[model samples]
Target: MFLLKVFFLLLQVVTVAVYSRADIPPPPEPEPIEIIELPLPPVASAVEGSCTSGTGCILQHAGLVQGGSFLPDGNHVIARVNYTGAPAAPDPASVYTGDQIILVKADGSSFSNGSPFKCITCGVPQDSSQGKTEALDYPQAFRDGRRILAGTNIIDCGEFDLVSDECTPESTFIHPIRWNTAVDGSGEGGSIRELRLHPDNLHIGFNSFTYDAGKLNQYAYTGRLALNSAPTTGLPMAPRYDLTNVNVLSNNDTRNIPLIVDRDQIRINTDAITVGEFRGFSGSGKEATYIGYPRESSNIDVFAVDLATGDVRRLTSHPEYCDPIDISADDEWMAIMDTRGSNRQMFMAGMRNVPPLTDIISTTATSSTRNNGQRRFFQPYLLDHYGDRDDYYGQQVNAAGDGSPGSINDPQWNGMADPRFSLDVTRLVYWQALVVSPACGGENPLPCPNSTEPGGRTERLMVAHFTSRQPVPVTDIEPLSDTISWGTPYEPGTVPSRELFISGGVYTLYGTANGSAQVTIVENGDAIETVAVTYESYSDDGLTFLDGTENITVRNPTVTLNEVDWYSDLTQRGQTNATKKTSPDGFHLSIDVNTNIFNANGTLSTTVNGTLYTQPANGT
Candidate 1:
């Protein structure tokens, strides 16, 4: 029985081996593999190398556009443009080659002569009997929309009228004005760094230098003139032009009388409100305010001085350097640029109620108490906070010695400057330089040959829209939907659309939107409505995409009275008119007025009573 079982087991093993071999069959012949190639997509080419439509475009040869201000209607911009090369030396026979003041559309099209506006005094040599023509520097649009203000390298400060295409020189201080000269041969005074026209359009504030007792002194002075004043036709009087006699608001004299508010410290509100540096009281009312290192330390804090009373109170405090840029139309908030952190950034602070005069003049207060009190006046909140990604704005990492060939590539890195608010306070505009490259070439941390050198940067004019009635996180700040190199560098005083007063009406403005983006209008702390706006990638030849627009939904949209024709349909129909006015606090209130009607007898009748009431977003 054992022998028979062993034989059966051997047979079973042989059978299993045979079956496994059968299942393996012969290895199939290797099958041939197939490969396929796909065609590449077409490349889109730009029209004339110009970016006509898109989220952003680069204006390759637009020259250096500086000191830009949007027109009152936000349709155009006025700026100072310096052509690609340095100006020729001033010569009596040579043509004036100074910088040009120009008006351009939002689409980068020129409104004035596409060429440079002829400089009024460009060809006259410095010592010519005809008097030297000064070069135009900064150009700013007036609130009225018809005029612009610009500073000269000499005594010829003036305004250029858009309608007349002429520059009218204004009354300036009588001093030996010098341009581009070193202290040795140059006159005691220096060129005007800033020229600010008062809101009344009658007075001007400027930063300049004057020789006093063999020493040059810097001052912030005010020049006053009657309303509707124009510059005298010829050369200004010399040695000291006191025709418009300037009052020294702040000076660098030994007495430090009145304190020194540098040009950077002056902020002009829409209502002509001026806040600057003042030094009436010191530690326990002892020392002069403008006596420290950053040039005016003791009096460096911002102050709202009663120009009428000579009374002044501090608005901001120390550790962080604060320079006021602008004040809201309602005077409820102030925008500032401060160096509180590693870099300077834009900030906004609520305006605190002025303290009682009694508290300000108290003599027994300690320095600590005074500083603490001043600190309470403003609680600053950062506006452009980029955290670790601070480089969203350009970084100045490659200085001369940090691995670069020449200083030519030294980056024009900029921190946030020129914080501006719309007249309605619904938008804010500021500028920053963004870095495009860390190193110019791949595999080498050095500038590439013929390429935009390493650390290449571009200036961007950024806009933030306040869409929420309630205060939102700073991170939610809205940049203008489009991207373009929109502004100049280092100009903190130009506020685009700051004076644009759009009365209550509806109108359309262009913006870029994607399918995921929505247009929202918030009223009285609620998102009253939202419209889903879509964008289609458009190509003129089906290869390159262009910018397309979709309608944005707005509730009780506002338009400027300047934009409406009073004699048109509203008056002809004798329709009752009602519109909402937005307060600084974001509340909407209705203002109702009956239209002027032409009586059957042809006499014009005026509406006697207008009503004001709270209104919903739908105007119900």
Candidate 2:
């Protein structure tokens, strides 16, 4: 049943309406609430483990576990391993054989190795330091129990047979399209990175770079491969780009790396492909907009192509580097990492005038033409800077004093990367780096000499709630305050009393707990409805609700309570306290809650049309 759920989630597709800035709705006004501080739960001890010489060496280093994902049940975690080294010995031979695919039981008591998925023609270099054999990077398991693996030179699909609980050799597809021998030394040899599986699971997309002679070329292609293909037959032919009217071949002069298609955008019957094209290299000497690269050559601009119709449209024309990171699930907004400024920042722009499938596929053109007089499609609003600290550079000290730390010794903020939206499009998560001082030996101010210095740097996972506008650190342990609630009142003028019909409004709550929690809605000291709430993990977070949790909503609930005494679990530790205010005209209900427990003494303004109620047990 769990496997079936995973399979359906992979195949699920959704579409959202694109809107212009003028058509976009304004964000909801913030709610009002008072917070009472409580002691945080005891921080749990670190999960302790040690790798003895040869037995546990693989788990010792930093980059060994490059990327991973858990199965639905979370009893197993599948990951791509790139062995670096251990503290005792820099590079251990037993572990550093090459890049390996591995599956470990969640508790670390057992593990299964899936390595030597050998490339048919690719040769293993005699030199051990050249890096792992084929150097596989990202490995992901599909819902059907198949694992898709990517490396510098090849991509492999490992088929898992449920009966034997093993990946059979014949079921694997080892494709060398990205690492052809003719291309390897011909200066045309390229590496495939950022491999993404399309929604259909049959098609895969990725960015590949090849340097031939004096010119450098980048291409993005989605190819068709069957799950049951014979391993001895070699991988399928390279995906054809020209067939889709994506001219990576003819326009070799310009760098035309395809922007990754948002997985959400690849649904049943969708033909549009989003990509980034370097405009200045057209050889036509057109005016360049992005200034990140040489002024003589512009940086990359985002464009969308219709595979079915061959129609192409420019989506953004920012003067600075505005690269598409990911599109929102609804396709209404696009999240981009804007590098126009000194520090990398996250921004969102309304997706406007997106061409339909019929319009995109039916149009015929040898090349995409710029939409003349079209307003720059991307009018990005700044979300947040990738790094919190503004005092120092990301690495090594320089004479310019850019790397000097301020008095606080705050974590040196590195640029943000891999910004992705939640499936619901209400939250965003990204990776952040901070250089911290090691306890023993390091620079006085820290993060100065360099991140390579004794202590090294710390990578932090961060998340932001679009509606809440607050950035929170993602901790290994679950949040103490797991649930938050907001409510609205109905028929304001119909009743003169402070009581309002909350039953007419939907009540939504967000949580970070792993299992189910009982949500009891109360009215006038009586429990009206007690519903069991189950929490699901987001993609950015692991199977556990350690990152940011999911949101659950109760619609049209049957309950009416005084605005002052609505929430039932206010006195419960780690539970949220909320208050609702109606506008003077009685048209809208403004609900607010003290969401963060760290700022317990926080107070809300009482001048609105609602009374502030305090719990006698825990005096405010």
Candidate 3:
């Protein structure tokens, strides 16, 4: 589940910095929703206590998991964790005696000395902790329920047997068998990413990078795992495994040599099998999934290229960013992490199907915009088997409940890579981290929202349950807004709405509440009065009013004096109650407007509120 596929950008990302325009700042992130623990109902608490608190939750905390998956039993999870309790910790193989492959209860509960976990290696009596460097980034638990084909070798956690609700570890059960990691095992000595083990259990698919001919070339490859009679490599001890019959999917000149006809706008790159990075295999294991060369510039999506036929099918079509994908065993569902509702990429690719040819050159910029500093604006989405068909992006699993922190669907806790489905397809397992400083607060421009996930833990593994093993139906929904990009101080930005929203700030952020309405008078079949009004009405999260609504009533059907405009300024807590009286027929009108000043960014929210009193007959 690599977020940014091109690791070669390590150069540009280190040297250059990307910032949003100063004036039209990135919209403030929503306030932190409070974290509260809720006990599952007795009926739903049937899940095992080893993996959960026995709480059958839609989104349960599966411990402090990072890039891990459920084992063959569909009960416990396996991730390479460190003693420091931090991911990507300092030298995972060197820090705290190098991180060992440990399995913890999904609730992040640790026993004495981090016990109660099924310690497959390191501290177990059957394990050998001396001499060898222990490390793994992508750990794959084989279906055999014993061997783990993780980084560089196979971790034989002989039997994942648990006693007293714990994976009882034995030293004799664990040993490492080194393998020839890649066709060119030259990076960091050896490395592979976005690694996937095919269902056949004999072959594997992955992506790797190699510097060749003074250029850094990254390619996707598939190869068979074998125990060679001869020694594989001198780096690790002998009696090792090797990747035989290796096949490089995108290393050849399969892609067209781009011809820039008119600058970068009209460049020509053929739709060859240009696999950028290997994602994984489809559920059926017939087609291999990867992030292909951009079909539409700046819109990076998932594609399944047939391993046999070389035909390609686009799995996702959203203009916003998406990566970190997994297909269900039936290939009917796709669980992925994305930035659809965050408006994170709205600054770049949110213009929808109408992308500019010139924007083709900015694909890297567009892809990188999915992240900010150390934060990723990703949330889990459940796509149907059809991928993104017309307007149908997958369902946001967490978008359902009231998105309070620690709840199943808290939007503040951003999703992370590699969502895996249970073998039975009843559960989806993934991870997330709360957004904190630098990406939100601190010297960065965005407002500092607090973390409601208590005790200050940043990331956690989340598991979601489905009622049944059926694919969610798909439907198209045209979003309510468009944006104004590339604006500067000389001309500030503008936000326009479609038929769905009022002309306000919904485009700035999704899920923000607002309102719009049109009132008409049909007196004597003549066009007498028509009032069209648009408003901002998010609660305390709103941009305009805060607590309550404003009411106005007028009784004047005979008088006609309609040529006056009026306004009022409200304090932090106040309502405007004004009455206008007109002569001739004792015309009277009362307006009670309740407005909140502290709602959000604008003097209009604080400064002015417009109150009108008029009808078919007029008033002053």
Residue 407 alpha-carbon offset, candidate 1, angstroms: 25
Clashes of 2: 6
TM-score-best of 1 and 3? 3
Instruction: Quantify all predictions' global Cα lDDT against the true fold.
Output: 0.27, 0.26, 0.46
Per-residue lDDT of model 1, residues 266-372, tens digit only: 11111222222221211111111111111111112334433433333333443233442444333434444443332111111011111111111110111111111
Clashing pairs in 1: 174-240, 174-241, 289-299, 505-557, 505-558, 505-559
Clashes of each: 6, 6, 9
Name the runs in model 2 displaced over 4 angstroms: 1-50, 53-81, 84-133, 138-145, 152-193, 208-213, 227-301, 309-324, 328-335, 338-417, 420-429, 433-620
RMSD of each: 34.1, 25.6, 20.4
Worst 10 residues of 3 by lDDT: 594-603
Please provide the root mean square deviation of candidate 2 (C-alpha atoms, Å). Answer: 25.6
> lDDT by residue for model 2 over 1-620, one digit each (tens)?
00000100001111111333475344333322121111111111112223323322232223233423333233344444433232233433233333455444432233233321121112222231122235454443343545444443232333443112344334444443332223122322234455543333343444444433222223343443333222222132332111111122112111121211222221122222223222111001111111111110112234433333233334343323344244443344344544333211111101111111111111111011110011011211222112111221111111122344421122243323334444444444433333233311242222232343122323322233355433232212121111111101111112111211122112322232322222222232321222222222211112222111111111112111111211111111122122222223221111111110011112211111132422111110
Where is the poorest 10-residue window by lDDT in model 1? 1-10
Error of 2 at 33 (Å): 18
